[model samples]
Target chain A: MTQIVRTPHEGPRAASAKRPGRSAVSRRSVTLITGCVLSGMILLLALVSLFWTPYAPDDTSGGRLTGPGAGHLLGTDKLGRDLFTQLMTGSRIAVEAGLGSVLIAAVAGVTLGVLAAFAQGWLDDTLSAFLDILIAFPTLLLAMLIVAARSATLGSAVLAIGLAQSAVVARVVRILVKRVLAQDYITAARTSGTSWPRIVAGHVLPNIWPTLVVNLALQFGLAVLAEAGLSYLGLGAPPPNASWGRMLQEAQATFTTAPAGALAPGVLLVLLVIGVNLVADGLRDTLDPATGRRRS
Target chain B: MTLLDIRGLTIRTTDGHTLVDDLSLTIAGGERRGLIGESGSGKSLTTLAVLGLLPDGMTATGSIELAGTQIVGAREKHLTRVRGTDAAIVFQEPLTALDPLMRVGRQIAEPLARRRGLKGAELQRAVARALEQVRLPEPDRIARAFPHEISGGQRQRVALAMALACEPKLLIADEPTTALDVSVQADMLDLIDTLVRERDMAVLFVSHDLAVVARVTDRVLVMKDGRAVEEGDVREIVRRPREEYTAALVASARRLESALDTRRAR
Candidate 1:
């Protein structure tokens, strides 16, 4: 019954007040800028692909499989379509798969984690057993099996990737949730007559969010790699539709004839993953109280 | 009339180990009582039982009445209401008792908002008054401060401020001054004692220190091996303890004081 009337800036204000003399913007600017720029580029690519492409990515008359030339920049693929347009459009699928898988993993993992910690006894044991079983299977193998069973649609492919990735998320989340539950603030919230839902939402969720966010960023990078692997193996987005993974598969066939075909998508994939990892590593270092000052 | 009445209370864990047994105690309106026992002697368990805060797997076959309402097997929602209104507990370690993440002002405001439905400026004013009651300097600044930024004594005072914010009929202080230095402990005890006297609030001061119990309580209950072996006036418990356990506790207390006296004399 104790209604906690939140002051608008209570959390941020207290954090800032505690560390006076430092600007909030300066505290996390580098990691924030890198994460934001990469994420923004990924988003822009996805949105732009929905409306238009520079050229018809599947058109034959555009080049008839020619190399890099005027108008047909970055050459053409086996289907005589522009590789640059195809790759640009292909960015959407990679981003979607990565983002989609993360969303699924986050929701499933966090819910299971919080529930397991809060609901002890049978519920906890049951969830723990299930997560253990799920984590034992390799993510790629599981996704492959799922795609084979479900007939390989984009939605099913993402679902497969998500299910594969969620095991790791669940494991990490369980540890963090367990730690958060044991914190004195949680005990204080309980003693204050805060309801169970409020305790989970207000007290539990906010405190565990930093770790979860860092995990999500790290997981997204892995999911992108995983999705790309699946697509290359012919279990990703269906043919005629653009996918970074599918593009990589096509590039492999034409590796000697036009190295850009394989190299462009392959290099982009590596850079994106590295960027994500760098940002994730930076976040992990920044958010951790023990090492945060060292970073500063 | 008694605000809290515990008669023949016994609490046990799932393993059938007795944590508190056959313990009878009472706190009438405006009375201050002390429950003195060393660690693991069940004084803290008795207090938690009164608040209905024993963790799951722990069983209590005891009558814990708060303001005439039995809370031993009360529903959680019912117990929740009882906590902020009828009775509240102040933990020994205030830094841990209050959430480190929350602002001190908001922590104090929780009970008032819960029991009295205070909001906005009224909530702020109530928090300010509670801080003042605990005699915290720069109440406004302290309100904005996180738990870590404050000293141990200040944190305990904040915990006291939180416990008193609801204006409960009875306050259960579980070694509230133990974590503080001797001088700060004295100041904290004085603050709690003065507040209880002024507001006519019954207090259950749980501690291991006999002298501290003697200073603040009218009656003392000495517990050992999860049982209340002796119960009487504070001075009588200190001077003429009947039970061997109580006598041993007093003896140890005297030994510590004489040791300190010897050190100070040099």
Candidate 2:
């Protein structure tokens, strides 16, 4: 017998050493940290807003079109409601919409994608074609159609955005599943007497999860942006909820006198989206094995 | 008793082009048999046919009986049951054969759990034991490591461990050592040889290297163009190949061995 000797502790160190060069590693970490911090700040603001804001989000106690002062940090809206309070509440709605839509997209989209990948012959062709048609339909248009069909409520907005986003998720998942299935390990799994369901749960999912996770992160940002767009169109969360999109719409008429009303929500939305995108890029760099890190 | 009997096996594409035509072979219990040929000679397809794992758009006809269970035309459900229990296969590329994301132990334990119902401590023990059987060092550590964490030779051994974990009556190894370094290849063949004898498992060893086949197998079948050109005892065939194709294979093996010998002499 040939003796095989290896130190278990060396395994992890060796793996880390094989990662990309120092500069690349630092860059990825910086992006990841910055994204986390930015998103965390907004999430914190949203969570804190659950109990208290400077004033009630819909309270128009301050004089209409008032500028920033000790009493009104971001000034008052056209209706004299606290802009700062509205921005905080808007963060809560944005996060909720992003999370809810992504949940729907991940579950429904991954299922459809896996199905399309596994289905053979006509079924696969049909599902692929159907997804193609859905993809061709613009996301905003689809959300509008669904929102128009249903009442303009938070649930409807979430459903509309999620349904529109699922097609994109499904298409991505299909390609990923196809790539995984074509690998020799899949063939090995089949020959090992592992059933298709077991193989999917055991081998396929684990292999594709990292990539799917990065994609879902990107989708979360898009979902938030989509929800904001819908709300701007008066189809998102109804009044009193104070989503950023709706706040933007309401602030449009007062842009010249009290620009803080529009600027606060708009900046927060952009920051949230940018933070999420940066996180996705960082995740892609770390999770993908192809981008090997070189040790100095 | 014959561990595996394949008769009149014919695999053809959807367009009706024959990839493997009318090949027949058998392996008795605990026998080590080899099928040797160059690439595209249908050696791999013949083994795949036995497992009912031929790729899409290809169909196999005739009978493949594994321990008296008919495999051809069998339902996928039934074939699945027979696969890990009655026969298992190891492939050419170990890197690709094993799941990159999974720990080696989990991959080995999967068959043991599904086929033998081994669980918990027993399952871990079985996985470690399988690794030990393949002569891998530090079974526990190796088990925890991912496929990519280990060396190529170690990965191939892990693949062998998985195939042999269930202690199947028949093990089909399709060029299992072809991807390994030459120095590692000899040890791999020796390990397979020792394990097959110890477990009394019949192995259907397929390779393009004549010398490799001769080392591990007692009976050798030389194939060309999807057909078995010659079959006989290893020594007899190596010494006096009857068919022209078999003769060419034997000659090549001799020339390679001599070339290695000359380098050693220097």
Candidate 3:
């Protein structure tokens, strides 16, 4: 019944109240803001693609393998589909797969990690061993296993990547939870009649969230990459569901004729990954003011 | 009258290592006793056993009767009820004992609201009163501030205030002042003394320093390794040494005090 109101991230006023003159703080904010812009651009592109993409995602009216010109913005793919339109469509899939897989990882990993934190002796050992084994399995191999077991589709591919990556998230959460539990404040809370659930929500969750968030953000970028790899291997979402990886796979054949097709998606993919990583690093600074001084 | 009674308590680690051996002690209502020992001497474990809050992979086998409730081997549901009502503990490191994320007022308000059923506005007033009781200046501001925002001494005061908010019959202080600045140690000890006397509450003060034990406790139990080496009246133990271990502890405390005194004599 007790509600614990916590600001997930501090507002601008609080951030400013800190020593804003510090170069380190400014640098992190710059990185964070830039990452936001990059991610926001893709998000906007995807949303716009939803309503209008200049041409249908599969439109092949334009001649095949055309270079950038007045009519074709970024040129045209082998199928004569508008390359810009396909890239726009690819952005939506990237965001969806990134978000969907991260959601799966966060929910599954946090639960398992917290449970392991609370577990003792045999249960704890078994869970830790299992998590390690899962983490050792490559994302592609896991995706292949899932695809073999079920039908290959976008959902299944995201599931495979998420399930594979969840072990990493769980491992991080377990360590964070254990550290939080060791703090004397946890004992103090217990002695003051706080229940376990309340302690987990109020103490354990809030204390470990900054690290957890950073881990999840990193996991997001990896999920996108894994999905792209899966798509390239012909295991991801089928046709009509154009992916940056699929686009890159198609472009490899006609690289000499139209390098834009390959360069466009490849650069965008790398940019998205780097942008997410920058945000994760920046978030490590911004969300954790208490540890900021020590880290900086 | 025997509010806190521990009989033949033994703590064993998972690998069959004994931490505390056959420890027996009792405190009547309003009586204060000190459990003195160096690090890893099992004094802290003894205190933890009183609340059934021992670490995982460690087991306590003995009777811990606190406010008429059996603590050892008690179910968590029952232990939860006894804790904060029968006894509350203030750990050594006060700065880390209070939640870094929570405002001090809300930290104190939890027990007040839970045990006393105090509502919103009323809970706020009680939190302010608790802070004032700790003699913290500008109670409102201190209540509003986070643990790191205040000094170590202030955080200890807040911790003491939280423990007292539940009005438990017994207060277990495990080296409470050890982590404070030297100047604030006296203030913290005095605060505990005054608050306990005002409530007529029993206290189990655990510390390694003989002088600290002498300052607040009526009786003292000297522990070495995992066994109780000596136990007697604080004045008697300090004046007439019965065991070599207790004598060494006394000699060290005397040396420390005289070193300070001789320097001041100049």
lDDT of each: 0.79, 0.87, 0.88
Q: Model 3 over residues A6-47: C-alpha lDDT tens digits?
A: 122211124334343588777888999888888888889989
Interface root mean square deviation per prediction: 9.9, 4.1, 10.8
A best-first ranking of the candidates according to their DockQ comes to 2, 3, 1
Tens-digit lDDT track of model 2 for B96-116: 999887888999999888888
Ranking by TM-score: 2, 3, 1
Task: Find the 10 residues in a row with the least total lDDT in model 3 chain A.
Answer: A1-10
Candidate 3 structure lDDT = 0.88
Query: What is the TM-score of each predicted model, taking all chains together?
Result: 0.88, 0.95, 0.93
Residue-wise lDDT of candidate 3 within B42-97, one digit each (tens)? 99989888988998889999898998889998998898888898899999998889
Each prediction's DockQ?
A: 0.30, 0.51, 0.37
TM-score of chain A of each: 0.84, 0.91, 0.91
Name the TM-score of candidate 2: 0.95
TM-score winner between candidates 1 and 2:
2
lDDT of 3 at A239: 83
Tens-digit per-residue lDDT, A127-221, candidate 2 = 99998898888877877777779888888889877877788899899999989988888888888889999999998888888789888998899
Candidate 1 per-residue lDDT, tens place, B31-110, comes to: 99999988999988888888788867888886888897898889988877777668878888876787655688877786
Clashing pairs in 3: none
